[model samples]
Target: MGDRWHIEVDRSICIGSGMCVGHAPDGFDLDSARQSHARATTADANEKLLAAAENCPVEAITLRLADSGETVFPPED
Candidate 1:
C-alpha cells in the first residue's frame, strides 16, 4: 500500500481564488460561499493534489500524512 494523505482547507485563509481547482479539479471545489474545500478528507498520495496545495495563493490548502500526521504542504519551516 502507498502513502495516504489527509487534506484540509482553512476557510479562514482561503480567498476563493479557485487556483486549487484549476490545478486539481478532482481534488478540490468551491462552495457557495466561494471557499475551497477538499473533495475527500483523505486520499491516495497524488501529484496533482500536491500541486493544488502548493498553488493555493493563501496557503489555505494543507496536506498531511494520514497515518503519521506529518505535514506535507507549506513545509513545517
Candidate 2:
C-alpha cells in the first residue's frame, strides 16, 4: 500500500449497478462486461468516492487504506 486509499470493486459481486458511475464518474465506469472498475486505483478518496462506496447496493466497493492496508468501506466484516 502506498499511503493512498485504493478503491476496489468486486466485479463478481457487482450487480451492474451504475450508482458508482453516477457518484464518481471520474473514477469509476461500467465496462462492456457491465461491471464496475476504477479508471485508476482510488486516487483521491474524495466525497464522491466515499459516496460511491456507500451507494453500492451490494457493498461491492472496497476502499483499502494505504498505511495499514485496512479495508474501510463495507466495514470489514
Candidate 3:
C-alpha cells in the first residue's frame, strides 16, 4: 500500500477563502489570481489533512488513499 494520500479539490466549488491552507499549509495552497482556487501540491496524509478537509466550508476537498483509492474521512479516533 502506498504511504501517501491524495487530495483533490473541485476548483469550481472552491471559494478561495484559504481555509484549506490555513488548516494544512503543507498540503494545499491558494493561487493569487481572479477566481483563485486552492491546489493540492503534496500527498501527505495525516490528522492535519483530515482536519483541513473537514474544515472546508464548501466541502470541495476530497481525500483518498493513493494506493487503494479508498476514501479516508471522519478519521479514526
Relative to the true structure, how large is the alpha-carbon lDDT of every model?
0.94, 0.85, 0.72
Tens digit of per-residue lDDT, candidate 1, span 1-77: 99999999999989999999999999899999999999999999999999999888889988999999999997997
Pairs of residues at least 3 apart in sequence or in different chains that clash in candidate 1: none
* Candidate 1 whole-model C-alpha lDDT, 0 to 1: 0.94
Best by TM-score: 1
Error in Å for residue 27 of model 1: 0.8
Better of 1 and 3 by TM-score: 1
Weakest lDDT window of 10 consecutive positions for candidate 1: 53-62
Error of 1 at 9 (Å): 0.2
Q: After superposition, how far is residue 4 of candidate 1 from its true place, in Å?
A: 0.4
Winning model by lDDT: 1
Candidate 3 lands at a TM-score of 0.76
lDDT of 2 by residue, 1-77 (tens): 23578888998899988999999899899989899999987485578888999999999899888567788787865
* TM-scores of all candidate predictions against the true structure: 0.96, 0.87, 0.76
TM-score of 1: 0.96
- Candidate 1 residues lying further than 4 Å off, grouped into runs, are none
